[model samples]
Target: MLSLFTIISFVSIRLAMQHLTSLFKCQVFTALVCLLLMGLPGQSYAGKILVYPVDGSHWLNMNILLLELHKHGHELTVVRSSNSWYVPEQTKHYTSITIPTSHASNLEDPEYMAAFLKRNIEIRSRDRSLSSFVALQQQTLTLLMEAHNASAHMVRDILHNKELVKSLKNARYDMMLTDPGFAGGVVLGRYLELPMVFNVRWITNSEGHFAIAPSPLSYIPTIGSHVSDKMTFVNKLKNLLHYSIGQYIDHGITRPLYQGVISEFIDPNTNIYSLMQGADLWLMRVDFVFEFPRPTMPNVVYMGGFHCKPSKPLPPGLEEFMQSSGEHGVVIMSLGTLLGSLESEISEIIAAAFARLPQKVIWRHLGERPSAVGSNTLLVDWLPQNDLLGHPKTRAFVTHGGTNGIYEAIYHGVPMLGLPLIFDQFDNMVRLTSRGVAKVLEVTALDVDTFTQALRDILDKEKPYRENIRRMSQLHHDQPMKPLDTAIFWLEFVMRHKGAAHLRTESYKMPWYAYHNVDVLAFLLGSITAVALLFLLTCRGLCRVACRKRPRDKKTKDKVQ
Candidate 1:
């Protein structure tokens, strides 16, 4: 009787354990469902998304977000200019709308763009004086205006295209994704009566900050200023001056152009500020690690590394070249898309530097092959950039400091040797150098010896650079979701919530002085001045009373005597 009782007890215990295991598994599955549901509140709903990228680089940056949206059952359409970098095949889920743009016609020749940039760089390098800086600023503004005009012309063409207009009217896109760099998106959004979201490819510019959020010049460095958040007194003054004068100049030049474009399609009387300020959200491609700490609005999302992906297997030739380096490892060099080819002199210097290095080199060169190429160097017209960066054998990256390239290098934990040439490149290099993960070499002053030494310094200090990058990589990856995933989630959130108007800061509506509390300062100053004047008047009245009484008292005393 005792044995039989014991056996029954054992069987009951085993059955109970099996039941508990099933319950745990059920709970786990339910929790996953809750998480996914939390990320996407209205998963069942979808909306049409219209995207207009500013250039090829901007288009590429938008690809991941577009793909994720498509995967979630949203309809996507992209408008491309004739010079658009994105091919139809690359954007699998996007309907391509090709339009003839005047900018495209003028910039169709890659060589022309390259030469134009080269000339500008040469001019600025020739004279680094204040006058040269002003000239460069003017040159930059002129180029920007030309680009804006091109964009406006494209918009006019689109509006005039009868078939396209008919199709757009029928489609009824839910939201418009645009690059704030191009004002045409503003016109389109107004015409369509859709909320606009900006996918800012670079650091947030003054216009963006002024319109979408408040970025204090005191803490937030102006774009291309090459200063950090913590500024010296001189730097602070310089930064303030740059922001003030730069905004005045930019607005003066672009306002008319923006008005011109808006007049054609929307109400001519509509304030350009209203159109520019209509952005519902701004998805900036910057990370806190790469940028200095500053106040950011809820509507401004940092979607840095949105273009990063898991490393794929390298091509056979590329793999072979990397493997050939063995213990020495390989170095990847590229100047990004804009300056595809380098001047022969610059190329020779780079090639000669690579020849002296123990590490094998993969140089992305579009120009004539440099005669200085060594056996260890492989010159290719194009490279699998991200893939090569992710390779275990890659030692260091020699880059032109494009934002995309910098992010990729950081994402892959590869140190950089920055050869900054123009625009934001210098600023990017400054950030990298400040972080101790890279060194900068001026393109204008680059020689074989200097280039080689820069490379060597990066290589010699590999341990610390790698360690710093590793820390940044960890921080960058330590997020609730991947950058691309976060971008898509917010995008869908905006759609479901019918625009993120609540997230926008009141600062956007504030005047420049009001936003910065300059009005408050003025009020305080006026109050102090009034008080000071009152005190002065009081003192003067007391002095007159004392003098008059003393004379009267003296006269009375003489009379008594």
Candidate 2:
């Protein structure tokens, strides 16, 4: 084909040369060559992006995304609170746009997380008592109410800041990238009227899918349900109840959380749920390998392990420690960024459990050392989690089931022993456990023996966990393009095209009745009912006429006789 195309080009060049001098021939040939090369793609212009990131682990992943965009020559402006611990005010990758610190952003206060974890641990330790359960419910709701109210205040502050608002309006960013875990970013994005993209897993109310996609309660497990996609009758019943609870939170709590802010800042008539659902694109931090197979949308691009990369070099001492594990291999433990550390009793139990193991352990501890220290264990305030997970001598991961850590372990094909603390952590562990990969130990029931057994179970060569996780890893890595690249490509696509409205669903604009086609169903049912009634009435009238005719005919016959 190349030779044939070359011959054709030569013929065309020859035809032109016949009417030109030798000096002009070279110029004509070069001109034709240049025209042929025009089919190839050219460089695209850099786009301006406004980022409104959720702090903590949410910021961890969002920062990775923005950095990649920076590498691609895009300008970024990150909106943050003055008191935000996770989102720094100064960064070389993006310009800072700070708003006044308020109660809304303070829901992310570190002390709040510690107290939340402490309260949850205390409640979980109760012996199936009603008081414990009540306490759990009350604390959770109180915390949620506080968080939502705080976020609303954050939104209000952002809107009321005339200078900040004016700067943003003047910037005219191509897109607004945000985490929809809180409605602060979502509300601001709508007010800015930019092409919004959600770096999302959970929305303000529930998991992001529940907000926009078709989720069947019978199969798609709700948060904290501790059930899988495949459910027994009882599990289905439990899932339904959890779904109802989610709905209550969505309506009773989450909606009202943002209503006042929306009314004052955006439009009075705008529904917060509708505004959240109206994003042009959702860069979902999810993968089918890690998640249940559920319904999704066209504009939602799943990039679950986009933050994961090839393991860079581990520090010399860490590498030596990993090497010292020899044939037994090592175990790495982390509770994610949110939880500082477990209660002392739980830590001692974990330490004792690790002490019993022959394999070396590297624990990322945030508090005072436990008394039951193991000779083989090395405790650090922080470790290169991805590097350790991807290490050849690393046998297993002991994690709190944070999505980032889960994906990193998945990326490395390391089986996990999960000690889920709170929030979506328990549910995240359930998915992996159901897949025959990770083993989960309830934090409330954490004892030395149980933790030891679970750790050994995942590390056992005879166990299918290693094999199952390896298979899952292969599936994750088998993509045509790398997950991060795919994410950035689509994001840049949005910037290049201005917005992804063509891929977005207009179902967001439809009311609940119209979205579910309930109105259409009602009309069709009504039409059917009317047609059936009309048919019945016509039949009755015909029968009555026949009866009347028969009687008249009988009378006539009698008279004639």
Candidate 3:
């Protein structure tokens, strides 16, 4: 198990032994060789790693990371449910640790996700009113409840499996790599006394930063707030309200869901709301290039656009279609994996809009074909999204504002026409729009005329979107190192150090008042008030004594007269 440094040093010593023997003793040379091997552990021999990943589209990026780990000769063992829809049972990159699970039209079921999206679209498309907003909040709560319940069930199964627990301990994984969106992995990592590194943007309850770092509501917009960093007074108020709602969901819906399982299975004293915050390292899936500038932690590493890369050759016939667009180039559209479908009327409008455009269009349409689809449009069940976005001919992107797609667009410098339907897409689009690289349209307000004009504006050479996005792309590429490589470095850094306790903040262990210094502020204010009151009393007493002395002096003067 020689390291890169060891191999080079050994070769140099063998070649220069005659010269070295004249300068140093044999023991010195031996010690130098040992030091080379021991001190320069360029990754410490790729230690064993355990992965707990989320399924569906989330698995796609996690798989990329796992493959990279495998390339470095790290052994990976992934924990998955039997009902997982995306994670494969077998892969050369990692061994599967599958748990038995039962499901019917529920979590990981295509129908369930489809129905959820459908319901979300319905709620969002409704008129803006109190009832509608309330309904949306309720829907969000329900979804959280169901998702955490399923995760808790899987966690319980894993913990209760006596044989599996013993096997896990015996295998001795160096650390746990996971998506903190689910609490199961965090709890388990603690149980095994293993350091944790999170591949994350979202946690169980809200955004990961809100849970781990000092996030100010003044500028950091909440997810569902539909606001930006440079917010107006009203917009700032909206952000605060939305953040409060998020806290409500975190406490009311998510905490309750996992509280029982955590108390019974993991540590009883751990708080579900902040459990994920205790991870040794956070490999943030986004960076300042895409996300707005905000306070971040030392352990939080930004690796946005890590999955993006130079365009490879397009699939058969795809290059021909892209080339056929000529002067106008091409427009690409994708709504992401789970929520790719659109209503019949909306699809009709979008297709009609595409038909009028001179540029050739490629849409990742999964549902029924639209009647008004253009002859120039290519509808595929799936497409090489990164390849197409990275293509030189990709003039504009129409997307649902998934973080992956947005980052890919940013990486390729592709301006966007946003149709943000649900989840973080709405806020993601808000950021893009504020940057002037995107045109956002309300789903309910979308029409053939508006959709056509928006697409045309993005494709128009005179528009600033192209230039703005190109600038963003430049900034994203200007990093000292690639995001993926940086992620790997930190991952290995954690393993080499056993854990990054120094980088990790202990503020997570403190109560809210203590963390915020509320108690400290209260004590200081009380001390100052007490000192002021005492000073005022002494001044009043001196004034009274002086008045009494003046009266006595006047009476003595009268007696002398």
Candidate 4:
């Protein structure tokens, strides 16, 4: 009896072991299936991506984009000028192709380019009154034509480069991501026959109410529009004339060179600004945190604070520097890329303003130090801007109101003292000032006292600027999805969808005047009047014939009688 019981127990144990083995196999199969499903190409990963940067600068806003692309598992390549200087932090992972650009014989270096631009601005300003505006427009046209020619040469060099052309020819990219400000990339994307995506790193025209190819904030001095935007009837008429003159320059001058020189790469019909409007998607680096309510397209995604990355511990020396700045907290002063390394007089004015301030100042001075340095002020050639802003001791920002800077300040919920130098800075400051989150200091007119007072006012604890900025910061932080994630999602979405053609707007199909439907009323009146005149003429001819025949009838009646 004992032997029989042992046998049964042994058999039971063996059966149970077999059952467990079968269960394990089933689970293993399920897991393999799951992995396959997860790894299968989603709708988003279908094509190659080409990213063209405006220039190689840390401020180009390409770093976060590259990171996002990596997370999505897509390949990207960048086309940049041979002379480009990209910061490692911004371009560590991406593969780049250097194209030869005949930008100008004079702008051989960045410093030279900076001085050249400044001189150009000064010359244009001086000639504004003395020169016939039309003559001035013609000169501007000549410059644009030259720029287009330069861009064309670069495009041809890129297309003809044996290895480069082979790579592009072999790679089946669905879309091209480009910053339209760069004439070369703008023209190149048009020829690629792939869908274009615009990353408006700065403010573009509020779509619909007006389609400014670039941002339209022109009230600020030094970089405002040469054209007028006055509201009066005469001013409106003058603006119309001005725009016509400007278009003449762009078309009669710039476009001709692009066609004659660069036409080989792009289709004859495809052009830069015109083709840009037909882009499959647009990512505007605009946050509701900084810019106010404005018209934007349904397809236009606002990914303003996309540049913010995971914060890391501050460097030991930097941490100590901040700690030494004391309890009131330190202020970050930067004039952004365009205004960096300004003239000595301008730098002195900035330094003098800082000397008056009581709070510790950390100025990102990219040039030589001022002759007089205050103990309270610390000058660094560069700082990890986003990291510094994210720091607790960062109390306020003194900026030139560049779009990126404004958005960064908003992301950190820091108040601003704006010194708008040019371009869309005026519009950016106007929005900030209206919101009471910033104070605008027009650099052309601001005195040291005015600048100091503005900074002081913003730094005051009770000031609404601080409170308002806090509110905006909360809103910025409380976003449904982080800007980077949103950017990645769309970028991936385009890859999966093979260019997101459904997102493209048809506004470009209409002519400039037709877009506004200005001719509709005239068309209706002309059609109606033409039909009425035809009917009137027919009736009048019939009446005249009857009148002449009546006399003949009377004569015939007399003969019959």
Candidates ranked by TM-score = 2, 3, 1, 4
Q: Of the candidates numbered 3 and 4, which has the greater lDDT value?
A: 3
Output the worst ten-in-a-row residue range by lDDT, candidate 4.
219-228
The residue-by-residue lDDT of candidate 3 on 319-431, one tens digit each, is 99999999889999999888666898999999999999999999999879999998999998899999999889899999988989999999989999999877899999998
Candidate 1 wrongly placed segments (more than 4 Å):
1-43, 82-91, 101-109, 159-167, 201-210, 263-273, 461-463, 510-561
What are the per-residue Cα lDDT tens digits for candidate 2 across 1-561?
579889999999998778577658888999898887665433375789999888867888999999888887889999887778888888898999877755745445778788888888888887668788668767867777777787778778888888878988998899999988877888989999999999999876578898888999889998878899999999999888778777887888888888988888787877778998898999998999989999988999999999999899999999999999989999999988877579889899999999999999999998899999799999999999999999999999999999999999999999999988877998999999999999998888888888999888988999899999999999999999999999999888888888899988888889889998999999999999999999999999999999999999999999999
Model 4 gets an lDDT of 0.67
Clashing pairs in 2: 104-150
lDDT of 4 at 292: 49
Error of 1 at 151 (Å): 1.5
lDDT of 4 at 181: 46
Candidate 4: tens digits of C-alpha lDDT, residues 1-561: 569989999999999999999999999999999999788644346446887766534326866676567555667778766655552323556677777665642222466557654654455445446464445444444544554466556776777777876778678776688765445565666666676777764312122223333333332111223222333555455545544554565466556655653556656665555666767677877776565455456667888778865456788988888888778888998877654665566678778888877778888886788865577788887777778887899899988777777777888888998876544566678678867899886564556677778888999998899999989888888988999888777866666666766765676777767866778977988999999999999999999999999999999999999
Q: Which clashing pairs does model 1 show?
A: none
Candidate number that wins on TM-score, 3 or 4: 3
Local error of candidate 1 at 334, Å?
Answer: 0.5
Off by over 4 Å in 2: 1-43, 129-134, 535-561
lDDT of 1 by residue, 278-358 (tens): 678888887988876666677888888889887899989888888989899999999998777677888889889999999
Q: Predictions ranked by lDDT, top down?
A: 2, 3, 1, 4
C-alpha TM-scores of all predictions: 0.82, 0.88, 0.87, 0.79
- Clash count for candidate 1 is 0
Which pairs of residues collide in candidate 3? none
